[model samples]
Target: MAGRTEGADLKSVSPNQPGKDYSRYFQPPSLKEAKKRGKADVQVHYDFAIPEEMAGIGRGKHFLIRTYGCQMNEHDSETMAGILREMGFAQTDDEREADIILFNTCAIRENAEDKVFGELGHMKSLKRDNPHLILGVCGCMSQEEAVVNKILAKYQHVDLIFGTHNIHRLPVLLRDAMYSKEMVVEVWSKEGDIIENMPKLREGSIKAWVNIMYGCDKFCTYCIVPYTRGKERSRRPQDVIAEVRELARLGYKEITLLGQNVNAYGKDLEGGSYGFGDLLDEIRKIDIPRVRFTTSHPRDFDDRLIEVLAKGGNLVEHIHLPVQSGSTEILKKMARKYTREQYLELVRKIKAAIPHVVLSTDIIVGFPGETEEQFQETLSLVEEVGYDSAYTFIYSPREGTPAAAMEDNVPLEVKKERLQRLMDLQNRISLEKNLALQGQVLEVLVEGESKTNPDVLSGRTRTNKLVHFVGDKSLIGKFVEVRVTEAKTWTLRGEIAAKVEV
Candidate 1:
């Protein structure tokens, strides 16, 4: 019962409590409470309006948001930005110029945490220079007690601290930090009710992130997302369909439905009859050019979903199914709930249904008890799958996870060696996969100018492969056919063949 922590034993706190004594009104993160799964009904709220008193509080002020980690965090930042914009706060990229600064953090890895702390230390000088400036930390990191405790002890200049459940209340938290002498802390330990109609200041018109659901319930042993994100809850299908229709009407070229475990959508609803497949089947008929979903759990990926994706028009051919390990024993230790054979069988089904499907995956090396033979199995699996790309990482324990308590017998050098081997295999497979596309024509949705070379424009094919070519800047948001001339390990060099009619 991972991520089922409804009615968790949280510290009682009054809403919008403001003061120095954070413990009085804050429900800080607790692993014990987070593991509890009560039968509380998941709540849904349609109204989410900014507080009347704080409506104009951000007038004549500029804010900056530094986002880290997954696409969900990026979308959360967009919602926060939309709220701030409603309060009349403009956005700034320069740290020195911003009157308000917020760090939207991630807690998936220790390295990400270190980078955030390093940036916070640098921000100390900025805070001292402008004493009136308000600084905040939100997202998954703030949902952890240890992280919040460390911030309180080390980064006292931080004015506000909130968590994932209560982002819609940012106006109140920001206002309290501005007026109160002490830090304002208001974090909910339980899963939040669904809040719809929140404004989003998306990064680009070409691509957008639409969150169809929130939280995870699978509770993988090596992960902290279950606790930090709370239990599984989904937005109503009508709400989701309406949002997609609106995005289509607005001329958005692509919309990726996001979730911690996207394939588990609609399970926590009242009747629980509908699911992600049914939703996708409905979304595929929309006028939008392209649609995608991410971070799927293999256990929840069933035949219905695969069938819907097969009759694809707007549903892209790319699937990012994360197989954390290739060893059945390792997956058991990680609580992935699926065996190696089952995963391969799922891949087989997908390949049979969609002939030209471009598959990608996530792999982790050096789990606490992983052996050399287990590592080799991963390499063999990578070669067998022939994934177009893979995200590989060395295993690092997070404090509150069950895996952290296990004996970490694998040494650092061993972990690094294993990771390198995994990457090498995946890289070779990627190059081979891309090289097959040499001279093949692809429809690329032009995102924008290439980050490295402005003279060249960059885009992604429907399968989510990156392609770069020399093109007019005006083609930023349109789809065009490109002839792939050269293929590298990770990217493709291409030339525009024809402009696509919208």
Candidate 2:
């Protein structure tokens, strides 16, 4: 710890580099400032070129980013990787070989943060062995005041800490951390601007994630996203469409338009009446084989979006509409802004528009003050909806959220029992749905080899069902027809019915 601050006041100057704004590094995330949705317009920057002085700073370095969170975080990691590569840093899967290691973290749950902290403790020896190695923490977790302060006090070896808003400033931050003895921390508390023309090193060529918007306005009481992510601001529709078109041209088979709440896209656009449905209507005409968007709020599932989705073509029939709770009373407590009947009505509308739709949702089992009757209401709703699948969780209290202050009346054993029941019910429903697909031929975009078996291949259908089949290595990126021969609770085993010649 003493070695960390040995030259804290000294700043090593890089050759030919101008002085930087050191005060910017002093800013840390503030929950109070993040909560405000001011009238200031979100500035859009079309130009995001890398600084010339730091262009080759990473010429002899390698980086490894351990990401934890949702698809949004995964996509953010891609952008950061692209930036690092542009600065001449190569990516490595092993931490031992990395000169700079970054933990792109998540703050949605306590367990996730615990896992990251455990890893940070494990990295202490590595930092001690290689004193020159730089360790950083970024992403949603870095956007919290408590999280940043905790790292400062406990993890003195961590040299860099930034947030989701200022990812475009990676080069500058990296340079500062590399040169300075003091820990560099820069996290924006307010909503960030929309940065265009940012580079990305996607995980794969077959499937991609394109972010259409940022932030969420629907402040669900149990959620910390609205604070960590800031106010909802969307990218220009033209920029989004252009990205999709370019992806299609690059032979990408699928793209999932990402957002904290995708349904409310384009609502923050100035002087424009366009909405998510309008954007979808445009992307549907692109040459991409499949298009999807996620993590929708049921309150924003408007009729226009349903009608456009019904047009089919590249718009896949799988919709991940998150209904956090089935009981209206619990939902009200969670501030979901919709009743049980309202959610069912929205589901009915979506089904009416697209009859073959495979519906999936999110459910929280034991929230604060939840009664058994309310839990039963959730079970009945699940039965009525006949959902293909669902992501269920026992409610985890997020710090700084409204629900965190509420009395956690639900006991630990009861919460676990309720979660078990919910998972059991959902697993049965999922198996039944998969059984119905047995002997039916479905179109699957072959992703890659199965993790467990090298001889077998893995892919997903139009409805986003994982199907494992034995195939040639060459079929990894092509769309093929597979007939389901066996069905399990979570996946489908199939044999190739036919192959599309590329």
Candidate 3:
């Protein structure tokens, strides 16, 4: 069920690669030229012929990758891990025990970059102790020009720096880094290519992440994703279905279809021959038990998808639709392409279609020019929506985003206060939502033990409510029906359902 590739191989058995560390090509990435790489209508043809073997260049070396940000980054880490495994590198959790440490970073927030730098600083002493250690930084953060310059100037200990594009060239890059005297930095911001056949290592047995598409087209003013991730490119619908089929064959019960804007899938290819709705319909035919998707854009979300969800058997009763703000002015300013009224209408339609559907969203407390009136509008929207849950954060401007250039008149104190107020509202709403579910029997897929109590197992219902119940360790990666005994803001306490009907 694996997707086939269309790229021609550029064959060359290098003198020193994979195992041997002889540098033939090692050069730093030019951040200056990367700005123009993600323009619309750019055709990105992938290079699929990764060397079947890398001449054992990474043999006897230890490698570790710490990933940050969204599911895209998490999936990228899996791909990178696969590449590392192919290169003969052993995995390690401890950086002190590893010969190579890679930070698969995120650039969504300023704090994320700060955390990365702080870790890089900690690794400087480690690098000083073991000069042979190959420290690298990849993923979204490395795509930033300023971040890379800071790494090159201040954090010289970093040995490799590649981007979202050209991860298939990791073997080539790794071989170069092994023997080269200079740091290897090649961050390509090209419109991302559809790379199939990269070996993937997923964490969970029951749940898996299948990327339906890559990159983003919506240049939301406050977002750096379009720049860091590149233009929207969907994996062919057949290819996506094939992967899902494979996962189903392997006993995976659930899969969260991964994408920056999932509902925007298939718009870029073959003149809209197939779309996210069509893809979901095809996926539903597959034998998987549960299907879910995330980070959907409200503008692209249409009646077709809602209709499909309404007719669901395998599709879960949960949707994470991110309404970044509630003010029409804010939405317009953010270039979200959907008005607050439009968003609320969409929500209404979805709820009408599926009465038990649980809705979650992401909300930013304070944007650059947001006034108290606009903020109040946001609060009103929250109350109106009565969201099942929400991820609320104070606005943080990304450097290259359009919002960054605007005057951030909203004080930090004000932003923090708004954020707290938002959280307080959302928490109360969440508790109310869960409280309504109390005493109901829910079918929970046991993912793992509860973080707070090992004796209890933790899993989520099809409605995506987290339920913790007393269970054995053997129940992990299995499904069970639990009766809700208690309800809280974030999670529920439940027990094995009795034979008696509710």
Candidate 4:
């Protein structure tokens, strides 16, 4: 659920403010408290007051959404796009050709926030040139109090603003902003409720994102997801299954079950008996060719879940189990409940259950108070796990987390050096792992042409390894067996073994 390590290493940068750092503020609803809250009131209908003036305002308008962030934000953009299209807006790639521009932002990192602000400033000129341009900012960043306040006080030109909880209300929000010709700021900072039947314009024809649950209950001291995204809430299992079935009917080849903490699905519900494993079993029975889920926390991973993955009819063998740190001390400070041994045990079970499983992970190199010995623990874990791929980064502190207050003892140079060393180890391991497939044939779902070269097409193996091969453009959405001829650290090169069937 919480993907990255939170909090700033105080030793790395000079503290500009003097106080207990609220940098990583997450308020996870305790399971006890959730029990007392009782049945969540589900709001089924939105009061649609169509602004009279907006009737023809966007009659021939075209809009493009430049989404920046995780799968949650991507799915949110899909709903936003669907809502815009419902209001007679056509999609476009060129920002200059569009009447409306929306930025679906992320606030997990300071760099992310800075990029969004930079884009907003760039869009201001576009607004100045074409005064009718409707600029909106939504998503995690907008949910921040400071971000919203800055937008209200300085960037008054921002026509529309909303947060994660109220995406379904976009049509009305946009209409009101257009009609009033004034700033519209609406952001809710609290655990949110689920709104089902929200429309989505899925980005891919073959692959789709199906949200089985929402929010995170893990209040890792340095994380802000629990606050910004809200409490953990699972969609009705039937709703999720039906959505996947419909996607299959529409000829979708792949479905990724999206969630903040997918492993925690159904824990907040009435029975608490129907968990992620049960839901996976139901979905696996569906006719879809490929099924995958992301971002599982190691703590929630159990034998039942591992067994479900091992059963492996439709479930892809690729698991993105994020091990934020390897040191027990760092893990404790970050509030990751699992120890190094616990994580390795889980990994062993998963691999033992599902052979040839391609494992990927997220690793934070530097946390507050990390020492040479602690850093070695991370490196040793990487060596032991032999992760197929890893996303490694130096620690970045967010506002409102306990780690932000702790002195950052690891120097930036040390962080960089450690990160580089970690990456080097991962690269060697990745190359070694990929080399094992050099002589084998892998089933790869063709995504599209390779970004680096048009002569090649790229797709992913069932284990979620990227495979590039020479293939016809017509084979874009089909699954083909690619014979591995070369192996790179990050990708595999191959040729089509045979003509793709269907």
Lowest lDDT 10-mer window, candidate 4? 1-10
Sequence-dependent TM-score of model 3 = 0.90
Query: Which runs in model 2 stand beyond 4 Å of their true positions?
Result: 1-35
lDDT of 2 by residue, 1-502 (tens): 1111112432332212234333333333334545557878999998997899889888888999999999999999999999999999999998888999999999999999999999999999999998989999998888776777677767878988888888998998888888788777767666669999989999989899999999998888898898778889999999999999999989999999999999999888987589999999999998899999998999888999999999999999999988888899999999999999999999999999999999999999789999999999999999989899998888898887888889999999999999899889989999999999999999999999999999999999999999999999989999999999999999999999998653
Give the Cα-based TM-score of candidate 2 against the true structure: 0.94
Q: Which structure among the candidates has the greatest TM-score?
A: 1
lDDT of 3 by residue, 1-502 (tens): 0000113222222322235322212212232333344435535444455475574667888789999999989999988887888777878898888988889999888898899999999998999999999898988887776777667667777888888877787888777777777677676545456778787777767889999888877888888888778778888777788889999999998999999999999888888867888888888888888999987999999899999899888888899999989899999999999999999999999999999888899998789999999999999999998899998888888876778889999999999988888889999999999999899998888889888888888998898999999987877777789999999999999998732111
lDDT values, one for every candidate: 0.88, 0.87, 0.81, 0.80
Model 4 CA lDDT for position 73? 89
The positional error of residue 78 in candidate 3, measured at the CA in angstroms, is: 0.5
lDDT of 4 at 246: 95
Q: Candidate 3: where is the Cα deviation over 4 Å?
A: 1-55, 498-502
Looking at model 1, the pairs that clash are: none
Question: 409 in model 2: Cα distance from truth in Å?
Answer: 0.6
TM-score list, all predictions: 0.95, 0.94, 0.90, 0.90
Q: List the residue pairs that clash in candidate 2.
A: none
Predicted candidate 1, C-alpha RMSD: 3.5
